[model samples]
Target: MRVDDFCDYDNSFPDEFYACLPRECPDCGAPMEMSEALTQLHCSNPKCPSKVVQRMVAMAADLGVKDLGEARATKLVSEFGLDNPLLLFSYEPDKDGVPEGMSFDVANGIVSQLNAKRRMTLAEYVKLAHLPFIQTSSQALFGGYDTLDEAYAALEEGGLGYVCRKLDISADSDVSVRAARVYETLKMFKSDLYQCIDFVEIIKMHSAEMVHLTAVCSDEVGFPFKTKADFYATVNNLYQNLHVEFLGALTRNCDYLVWAGADGSPARLTNKVKKARAYNEKYEEHKASGTLKEGEHEIKIVSAKQFLYILEQLVK
Candidate 1:
């Protein structure tokens, strides 16, 4: 009953499930898209230098902004003792490595600063996008402002600055880095959810192993199992004895109900139906006794696929 024995295992990579940038940029008020070549970064700006600077400043502010509104001048002056801010701007256009008229040291230093902060806030990101290098499209990378309104609203509300200020406070004192950790934790949560869905889909492909399929609606939910047509086809074809029931009484009575399978067999389908009826009765009794909350209870409904996994794991 090992997972591999019953299920044909597929090693779908994690990147397949991860979220990507939305269709537009959130800065400089332009559309953002990938290039067909995928070798270089493309920007909404037709002018190349502004695109370059936008990209670099985005990179620079990857973690957070060290200094807002100030050009890389102060950092360069303090660290490298550059007498003239213009001295840092020399570059060669033809060279693919570092573009002409851009400060590599400054870019590198900004990158370091960003990494040190370990997170980026929306305000810092906007500030970075508005840098002189980005505006001029110098030797830097480009940034896009796809959702201009939403991004701008976040900036105006000071949410972005609050996040950065909190991070700065954490660096200075014993404050928790919760603001910084929020982004990383959400990403991990999404990764885990993807993995769970992948497991459920893999269980469905095993037609012989599927015993019972039931649909108990809490809300009309759709899943990524190919398409609506494909999902219905898989369920109907694999589990021909599929049962569809409306929890008319239970939905009106309880917050949630457990959709339990009986003896791990679709042939014993009457038992599951009976169990569902009894569950509603017991739930009502508990509700009358004031043990269950009127509006807050978790209902556990089983998918035919999920039930199969549960049965397999129990047998092992």
Candidate 2:
């Protein structure tokens, strides 16, 4: 049976199966067996550390991002009828095997109607957006605003407006930035980065189990240090492997790349000069051999801070 198929028959598992509250390990992405008797989950990997350091890292990562008190986030999540993390928000697939519709916005609206005073976290918003919905319209998942951060702040402040105001742009503009960030963030986790384009446009995944972060204008460009050649070489390969036409289109229209997938280290754009040099040499040889036609093919490194500035400019 397919690994994911087990999720469908989870109910078939005896009460003992769930009594312990077992889960997957965040670090190694391995299944963990929980022991209520021990009050902890154990990773089967004998050498795997308990991921203790990650806890502090996770907390630090959430420094400015979370506003809703743990109590409020928890309460709001429960009140919004999102008891199950998996049901927080989900996307229905279209005939093309892409996400067809989402009920997250409707869920957000419901949460607002239920409790106007409470705010939601990005994780909560993700959960709500993933909630199953039978709606006929609304293709995007995790609705209510364009961006996850905005939606999160709104959830905390009892509105999306405060987040919009922080962005210093019209609500719709902030929304666009949010959408772009979510797409980019998800892409970082998947094998096929471009597929994230369609995933953002179609499937509505939520952020509970992932890290959600965005760089703001407070970020100054750090000192420009030349990166190691190894990194740039990888970038060159990534650029070459990608469809240049697509990159050109993305470079022109894209802005802030808000990420919400795996969160540990912040995403970075390192320029590997040596790798780039090698790539150019290869291109020259390929052209001489009639393998690669002369063309301007390159990759764009959109840093988190740069991403935010780009979007701010776009909105303005």
Q: For model 2, what is the alpha-carbon lDDT of residue 280? A: 55
lDDT of model number 1: 0.35
List lDDT for all candidates, in order.
0.35, 0.32
lDDT digits (tens) for residues 7-120 of candidate 2: 344576676656545456654556665443545566644223232222212221222212223333343333443323222123222221221232355434433322221223
Which 10-residue window of candidate 2 scores lowest in summed lDDT?
240-249
Candidate number with greatest TM-score: 2
TM-score of each: 0.20, 0.23
lDDT of 2 at 10: 59
TM-score of candidate 1 against the unseen true structure? 0.20
121 Cα displacement, candidate 1 (Å): 20
lDDT of 1 by residue, 117-179 (tens): 322222223332333322222111111222224433433465424444533444444343444
